[model samples]
Target: MQPSHPGMTPYPGQPFYGWYPPGGYGLDPSDALVTPPGAGLGGWFARCVGAARRGWRPLLPILVLTQALPAAVLSVLVLAVDPSARWDAQLASDSAALPANFWSDLATLLVVVLGGSLLLGVVQAVGWAAGTWVIARQAVGESAGLGAALRYGARRALGLWGWTLLITLIVTFGFCLCFLPGVYAAFALALAGPVYLFERHDPLSRSHRMLRDRLGLLLGRVALVGAAVIGFSLAASVLESLAILPFGTTPLDSPGTAVGAVLTIAVVAVLTLPAYLAQLVGLVVTYAEQRAHEGPVNAAQLAAELG
Candidate 1:
């Protein structure tokens, strides 16, 4: 029995999005940016790995600036808020009862911490969103100008921001509810980005749709990405340790002190830059995949050139 249309075709050389043709000068809007067939869990992970390998170069600087700047700002804010208080039983009990000077210091600390936190949060959001756009552009092998990057981010910033806030609240509230289901919910919601980008919907809407349509795949992929992230983070931690000279005391050795301040700072610099750079590459490829095979970024639709 021959069916009119083959429902289960193999992933061919031409991508479903048709962004690029085989040996073509540029991608055709009409052509499908097809995935290679048999791309299951292993294949998907390989795609992530491959994307990271290819797009590491342009992604490094942007990632470093985006991640490091906000992190540094937050650290400064924390230090400013609580300058040096040893955690003895007595001190812990009487932090508020210490002295007039203590009250004055506390007030100053609150101002710095709160103000810095707010500022850093906004910048971090913008920076991360922009970094995502840059990675997406690179994934598609498209020209990524600052103007275009900003526009891409700006278009989706409000939705992304709302999504971030919503997820943060979910995780925060989850932490209060005995912690297990909250973790699952947080992981389950992680696919909102791919959904957001491809579906071109608000994060909340995307989250809902993904939950309904493909929760299993979404959760599975999130776990995969999380595992990969953790593995790389562990490797970075090891490298950070190695970066210190052979003879050096670790910061953790000292209680309530910046014991390995130098090492900590160095590690943040070394690990953050490269890790994000690689991640950005993976993001680009995934974006392309979703734009093609997945929902909204449809090749057939875009081919009509409505815009």
Candidate 2:
């Protein structure tokens, strides 16, 4: 027997969620723990936190492989090719003009960073898709596992990566124009990933509309998420810097110290786990809230769309 509700019928076997808002699209508040039924900021926060709690199990392994491990490897490569090794020795000898290998080292550093970032873009694409899939599914109480998410990631990686690249270019172009523009671009596109994952059409226009229509709400929410991730990364970076200090500026000078520094970088990478979780959960939850505001949407619809 289904419980009677005006204007909307609960899903079969689905427990009745609380009252629907006058303007809500039939999604009961109880359909999702991670997505409130068009709830306000407080609801968004609650769902964000709840999604994180439910999805962390899968999110962790996905982030560890696609984000943290790659980050550690990239750091090791950067450190290994660092021109600072020569600069450190030169400074110690009181030579101040320029290290002989400065340009060469700097060039190597640029190449390493550029190349690594390009490749990292690919893996990060996988992470974003997989993470979103897991979170959205979990929000709707669907069964989602690490293997399934990874597989989903592979399937969506290409199209999502292209969008990711487009968004990156948009931000880059904004930066090229000015700092303020860049920040604006970032906040506007902050929800682009989740939008693309769920909507799968005209993401750029859709995301921009969401931002334009609800500027303050979206901006504030994204800012909080951005702040959290940046703060965590900054803390991890500071820790890495402090940890490698014992090895001095030229941490790669000795095999023993080099290994230690590498280990420190790896640990720092692992420390970024929460940042990944925050970014995924916060953005997805925020997007869901935005959709709820726009029309009738719930965790199950989102989960189905994510597929």
Candidate 3:
């Protein structure tokens, strides 16, 4: 008989199995079997880190292709449709005779920009859903590859997009009412993705149900994740500015330079996709913990059900 793998844990209701090698067990040992901490914010953070470390292979590519790729494409499009370039050309041209199709050009640019924004939003929502799915699988000690995760995410893409739109509208409305309400609403709805993915329920209603009595803990944890994201993002922005210092000032004025800038930003986005994944993993783990708190549920069981 094969010896028990130190990394494998057969938690209650969940059995641990060793990975097989080529012509062996039919599983890859390199795919770490991670069991998320039972409860608490510390455990949540730890599980997020563990999940990222073990599942980066499956998670990173999905995030880059689904999230960063669309952002990069949109960035390029924005540069191509730059209003400043058109304005500069207009000013440089003969003022008495406006360029033909100037209005049509402007209309086309507007349409492209609007359409690209919508497309990017959809891509991000889908990416988040997929990333969450992967994290959920990893949290419960199950393994999933990029293709499987993407297919799963695509299946629920429409629901994820709808949920994202609903949450955005609600948060926007909350902000209009009051700043605090808006902040509260954002945190309150933060787990909608996990709820939608795992519970297979309407995002808003299920999210509200999850946050019912656990609002305080959930809010605190969400705030911690938000702060980390903001802090890291700010640091990345600073580093990015420094990195582009050698490119000279006003690098985006010319088309060639602007393309370079977009590529640089896209590269940075690709590198940082894991950070976004960590946040999602934390949220997924938290959702499972919350469910466990409500009843006799565990991460492995959730993973099996989600699987």
Report the CA-based lDDT of candidate 1 relative to the real structure.
Answer: 0.50
> In model 3, what are the clashing residue pairs, if there are any?
20-25
Candidate 3, residue 141: Cα displacement in angstroms equals 3.5
Off by over 4 Å in 2: 1-24, 33-38, 88-103
Q: lDDT tens digits, residues 1-307, model 3?
A: 2332222233455543443433332222222223222334556666667778877888878878887678768766765665654555666786676666678778878888888977887877777777777776775566788888888878878888888888989999999999989887888898897777766766677677667777777777778778877776677667667766655454677777776777687776675665577576767767765654453344565565454
lDDT against the true structure, each candidate:
0.50, 0.80, 0.67
Which rank order by lDDT, best down to worst?
Answer: 2, 3, 1
Candidate with maximal lDDT: 2
By TM-score, highest first, what's the ranking?
2, 3, 1
Return the TM-score for each candidate structure.
0.65, 0.87, 0.75
Report the lDDT of model 3 for residue 10: 33
RMSD (Cα, Å) for all candidates, in order, is 7.9, 4.5, 9.2
How well does candidate 1 score on lDDT at residue 266? 48
RMSD of model 3 against the true structure: 9.2
> Model 1: per-residue lDDT, tens digit, 1-307?
1211112232233233332334322223322221232344555566566545544554455455556656655653454345344323436777666544666777777887767755555555555566565544444455556655555556665666566667778877887886886876676566565445444555555455555555665566556556666777778667655644343333333443353554455455556665555444344344444333333242322222211
Model 1's TM-score against the true structure = 0.65
The predicted structure with the larger lDDT, 1 or 3, is: 3
